[model samples]
Target: MVMATTASTAAPTSLSSVTLEVADIEAARRFYTAFGVDTHIHLRASGTQSTGFRGFTLALTVAGPATVDSFVGAAVDAGATVLKPAAKSLWGYSGVVRAPDGTIWKIATSAKKDTGPATREIGEVVLLLGVEDVKATKQVYTDRGLTVAKSFGGKYTEFAAGQSSPVKLALYKRRALAKDLGVPVDGTGSHRIVLGGTADAFTDQDGFVWEAAASPAPTPS
Candidate 1:
């Protein structure tokens, strides 16, 4: 049942895991694991504050178009909001889902062949942030010791991937991001980036949130 895609596309710079915060850990895990994502759940007191989409994760290498449909369809079947119906996109066969916890996931798959299951069910997680100012947002990470691996004019940028990085970092303009999500460009609510790593919890200049992780946590919602 669980298998990694056989696509020959290069895997990301060694992503380890991606953790999400959910009020109901079990519900989140059930939804994510339904589609074969390696899911783990941890209990923490729910502070008075709420959670929302702070960022997104996009996986490029997948078994093929059918895999994309299966995963995206599964997410929708699990009560996820279909931000974009599975179809052709800038990347390949792609779609977006707003999970139960308000976390938006952008799942993408290439046209490559599907070999089999990966060590982990899904491929690397590319942490994507949507900001009004791309240059300023790029500076936030560059100042934090993350070097830019690639960048484009006022549209997109990706931080240099590390061997042990939990998820790769990327930035896209707000409008461009909204267009990708097939949503309106409001730039009002959360970007769904409540990510955790080996570092402490901190908020970026654009207000995205990240936390610290001691090890490769088999994390869930």
Candidate 2:
């Protein structure tokens, strides 16, 4: 994985792994396997107390509308609840689904129409954190050695791409993200997600935790 150069050994500049905390590990494994994202992330069994929204969502970006439909269909068939049906929007065609473990997922594409047949291929996976303060969160990440890739005032911030990580990182407003996901904000307790990287372990401003990874994460084939 590419990272910022230092006088000593270079430190990783991007997240290396993302692990979701779920109530039932086996069930979540089954769900993600069917949803076609099990290979992209890790899962853990946790009984931590958490209610309402977990303050985050993992998004899958595909090639076109038909691919989006295929993913959404697989998630539904695997027992995911549709928060928003796949349809054309101002930005693209997308849909939202809630996993049985209470994690939210958004599947989207920039193309309004399909140019080819649907396939179980995913182009990108983003972990969007819903924070109380986007600017503060962005600063926290920047200070930790992550470079900014995109910024929109105080509304959003995306970090530089991780060359070897399966997932990318970004920040968004809590209420705005909830609104976009068609859910109410105001979740409390555990965020139910953990980020893994080469950096030391710590919790961010919005309560998201990070842990030091033993080794670099493998890129999806």
Task: Please report the candidate that would top TM-score against the real structure.
Answer: 2
Mark the 10 consecutive residues where model 2 has the least summed lDDT.
Answer: 1-10
Expressed as tens digits, the lDDT of each residue in 1-221 for candidate 2 is 11222222344489888888888898898998888898788888889998898899999999999999899999999999999999999999999999998999999999998899999988999999998889988877787778899999999999987778888999999999999999989787898898887777777777888888775565321
Tens-digit per-residue lDDT, 1-221, candidate 1:
12122222222222234555566767766776765553432333232343333434454345566677777878888878888887875656777887776666777777544455432345656767777778976665565556788999778998876665546778888667767777665544544335554444556666665555556545554
Which residue pairs overlap in candidate 2's backbone? none
**What's the lDDT of the predicted structure labeled candidate 2?**
0.86
- Model 2 vs. true fold: TM: 0.92
lDDT of all predictions, in order shown?
Answer: 0.60, 0.86
Going through the candidates in the order shown, the clash numbers are: 15, 0
Query: How far out, in Å, is residue 176 in model 2?
Result: 0.5
